[model samples]
Target: MQLDRLVARTMSRFAKGGLASLRPRQAPAEATAPLAATGPDRPRGSGSWANEWVGTKAAVERAKSLARPGRKRKSGKAAADSIPEGTIRTKPLMSARGVKLHNWISDRLEAEAPTCTLHACVSLGAFLSADTAHEGHDPLAGLVADLLIVDETGQPIAALIRENVADPSRHLLMLDALLDADLPIIDLPAKPTLSMLWGEIAETLPGA
Candidate 1:
């Protein structure tokens, strides 16, 4: 009976030792201390730092590009150059009396006279300097012509007046002002067809 009891006790101790050997051993607290100490104050991981640096560099390059000079202006010779050699830009002529005055004088001239060029909105004062400078006699003082027809050599030909049916008085005033400035006026018909307007322009030309 005593021998059997000793064998049973030894077997139980061997079984418990085998179970403990099978279980995984926990790492020491000192071994995990370095991982726990890593926080915001510490340097970031390699991948995180590289990504942040790349983002910052891209932003700086973009800022530098914007600050650089030699930027093209939208309204001057640069804008004109961007258009094709023969294409004409057109816009609506604003009027107060609900009459839609189309101001494609430049466009039409460009299309018809490929050799002859036309300039839009040239100041009357540029040609009528003497009249404009005369005191209390502002002939072109608050008046603007639609276009200046010029030959390819840039010779001033005539001043174009696009008529608005709703404002006959204004048209007459502009016509008188242009005449006083000693500039030939090409008065277009109110709601004129392209063919009709072109015919009038052809007649107004010196040799046409």
Candidate 2:
């Protein structure tokens, strides 16, 4: 029993000493010393520490960049090329050809068509007729004719207008509407006359 006790004591001491010896020791002060005050390219320590520091800094910068907000997304309804509101002029918006046609019609009504009178002041831009002009009506709506001809009695004589060659679809639609309405349509040429217009209207009339 005494021999077993001595062996146990020796074993206990050996076990404690063995475990202490197996544990890793703290690094020397010199081994873990700070690098010299030098540029990154000239690091004093083994390159592993400098490389780890550089990698950490790079990761932090990358995280910052990722967290930054990006540009806001544009709305679906927003158009890059759309004209600003109120910027579009309601009147005097007609093309040069439209203006010339308006003047010609005005002159003819004043000189030859004494029974007919100018319906409204001619403007270059599209305008809604009293029949169509109402609340919720789009002022910038497409037009069927450049001018509406009316008699002194305020009867709609015809739609005296010109075709817009630039927009074939719009021109066709306008022409179709006039035909469906059974209204007289006088297509103005590059240069139109009062007599030619009157002749067309007379043909459409019942007892001309």
Candidate 3:
């Protein structure tokens, strides 16, 4: 009976601090375990962490998103090469030759097309164009140029080229592209007539 009582007291004392001691001892076992197992026997690189489950899911989704073509911005010669063999970025919106020169003219013209917008303006041109097939978040994302042209004598030319187009959205795109894309001097006309401008602007890529 005495031995039983003594054993009970001893067991109680060990139980009181056993959990604390077990924690430190178990750490070494966890260190040797696979990274995926977050338990005491698992290692740090075992890919086991508090957020490991959600991390794996997010990585998978990110990979899928990146796999889609044209979903991301391409750069350098590779980016320019992405243009199709037959489809040229500077193709004429009206005739087969006169290439649409500015991003604004092309984007606005597209917006006014059938699948695009169908509205027209008195002073400028139509609110949309005929070749437009899709829409975008900013309907007028590309419509005008933002620039001030000059001649040999530094006289500001009144030509309506991209640098001085009237549309606000187009202006912003031109500015952004100029700063970001290192654009070269492009050929444009001064104060292009409304008819000629629309004929040129309908099929341009926005901010291109």
In each prediction, how many residue pairs overlap at the backbone (N, C-alpha, C within less than 3 A)? 0, 1, 22
Candidate 2 residue-wise lDDT, 24-113, digit = tens: 434444434433566666635344443443443455455445434462445544323255434656555566876665676667667667
Tell me the alpha-carbon RMSD of every candidate. 31.5, 33.8, 26.3
lDDT of 1 by residue, 62-137 (tens): 5445434576545444322244443667665545321333335555556666556666556666655544456777
lDDT of each candidate versus the true structure: 0.56, 0.56, 0.38
Candidate 1's clash total is 0
Over 4 Å off, model 2: 1-101, 119-141, 193-195, 201-207
Question: TM-score, each model?
Answer: 0.41, 0.40, 0.18
Worst 10 residues of 2 by lDDT: 121-130
Candidate 1, residue 161: the lDDT equals: 72
Error of 2 at 168 (Å): 1.2
Candidate 1 local distance difference test against the native: 0.56
Span of ten consecutive residues with least summed lDDT in model 1: 28-37
TM-score of model 2 (CA atoms) = 0.40
